[model samples]
Target: MSDPTATGPAVPPLDADVIVVGGGPVGATTALKLARGGMRVIVLEQREATGLEERATTFHPPTLEMLDDLGLAEPLIERGVRADSYQFRDAKLGKIVDLRFDILSGDTRFPFRLQCEQSVMTRMAIAALDEEPLAEYHPNSRVGTIRRIDGHVEVDVQSGPRRGTIRAAHLVGADGMRSTVREQLGIGFHGHTYPERFLVISTQVPLQEELPDIAYVNYIADPVDWHVLMRNPSGWRILFPAPPSWGSDEDVLAPDNVLRQFRRVLPDRDADAIDWVTLYEVHRKVADRLRDGSTYLVGDAAHVNNPMGGMGMNSGVHDGYLLAEILLRGHAGEEVDADLDRWAERRRAVALDFVGKETEGNWSALRDDDEQRRAAQRAAWEALGADDEARHEFLLTSSMLSSLRG
Candidate 1:
């Protein structure tokens, strides 16, 4: 609990209109947008500097559109692969249906997923932030405490070599799943963790070239173990489901065992050709509420989900847009409490109703041994491809344009 009256000795002045905790995609996006609107925004990132991350490689259509609007998408497009279609396949490598994004051309200017590493986007975001006179990104700054007083929020953080306090009219927590802000605020993140561990292996093997039947992104279903195979700038990534029974996370990352697992996808690729690999625990959770007074939660700070359909980071960036728009209106003297509340409510709704349900369904459809259920999954996927209207509708929804419109 923060003591409102206690500034504790001499305190630094309120530095900005808003203080954003976390400099990941969501926070960076939020700070960038707010700064663009002529608001003084300070972004606090715990990392000493931004580094390349192998995670969150897919940017859906709507997110790209938003970035384009901010003049940040063109460089991303130049650096990333444009995935025009996505597919689902059986264990034996038979296509179920190829959902083409081209069908969404009428609805969105960018009708494809941008397969760019999040590290690339983060660098671009920070660069854009550097250009904004109203914005300041303080790296190596982790939230110390957030207090509310005088109808305003004050954030204390350890930034680089200095500990300072910055006050603002509002604040945001976009740190991550294990957000310090969320924990200190005592928000309940309720959900279950999947029993299986997940691993993503980078490979030099040209999976797209070797497996001509597959699209750039392929979700292959199996009765027991499901996997996601996608193309990256490096080469390819095999997202595998590893149970603890297989071994510890370290054992799963062991080169020989990992190569053996790749046999399930690539029977001919040599072991030594492997690039690198990593593993993580998987969970599905949403905060009990995204808002606590004048502060808000967005991105992984608000929710965490399995990367089944590549929805986690996409939805978080969406939260940035949602929050930034409402806050901008409020700064203009508009009554935006309703809009801010709507942002929190609608984003939470999106986490459960869209990201959660869809991703859970994705895993269920892949590993369910029941033949009838498998057939239904295939049917639904094919329906997304074969029918023109249905295909357009599917892309619109899956690409998250519908989520925004909602």
Candidate 2:
């Protein structure tokens, strides 16, 4: 909905304390936080609404703590399921290593992982923003151009029948992987795509009767068709790493193809219950810089990691939180240039050192057919299984609690 006052001729062509160029979770949360802090915020989304197609269903403990700070923990708990542990299986050894979330019990309020669709979180954030007077949501509004003049940032926007300019003290590009704002600012996103593609299928059948009470991330480390299966409220989400020679643009979501892959990876599941399937090419990329003057990039606009560890969405939300804090500090007459720099540096370190490495390693372990690679994986798991300290360290890393530290 357009703001009436903002549409009047008496009003300035563009006016806002901050302009967020993306209505995804990151941008929406940043705008909502700013509005809550009494700053006038405007968010522009190219999409008709904030309903995203891809699903990032796992929220780690640290991310849950950040959501709690935003007063969203209760609502999220109501709408999502909790995951207590992750099970890493080495089929060659017939050994399963259980990494529990209890290690973070003393460090954060949310010691367990939460499984909720990205769409659900977006809808919640949108509703929260709607109740804030200082926040205005502009869906179907695409940002065409951006310019930084003097001390203010200007943006050319097109929404339905209207085309206009928006000006703000600060601008944020939380758009996505192919961010228009990032392009406009000449920030380079550097990384390469994995040769292998990933196919994700969602099914309604109950695949956890053996461990019904515990929600664990299952990593099947088979060289032929390594996969991950996660439990959701409605169904189980299955992820398969396809061979490098798989089809590129063709529809891989067909039931036959999905069933074939499912049978190949997880032979135990019932194929008749498959509901939805999607195939995506995985890319590991990060922006060269997070900020340029009054404009900053957050979420996928800044970095995109493989979804193996479910860190992509979690890291994006964390970016929003960090940016919101810095912006609020700046608004309160604090010299936050150093704070902003630290935010970017620390985030990039975590993304590169933890998320990037873990996801890439998971991909390699899944795809490697060499006997040496299999033996190494077996040895690593054996060591991890024998030592509780090692198991906890692995859990902390997978749960993203380890990366929460500065």
The lDDT of each candidate is 0.86, 0.81
Top-scoring candidate (TM-score): 1
Residue 141's lDDT within candidate 2 is 90
Q: Could you tell me the lDDT of residue 27 within candidate 2? A: 87
What is the per-residue lDDT of model 2 for residues 241-338, given as tens digits with 9 covering 90 to 100?
76556664464665666788777645776666677777888899999989888889989999988887788988988887888888898999999998
**Candidate 2, pairs of clashing residues:** none
Per-residue C-alpha lDDT of model 1 across residues 330-367, encoded as one tens digit per residue: 89899988888888899999999999988887888888
The C-alpha stretches of model 1 lying farther than 4 A from their native spots are: 1-13
> Cα RMSDs of all predictions?
3.7, 4.5
lDDT of candidate model 1 versus the reference: 0.86
CA error at residue 209 for candidate 2, angstroms? 2.7
Clashes of 2: 0
List TM-scores for all candidates, in order. Answer: 0.94, 0.91
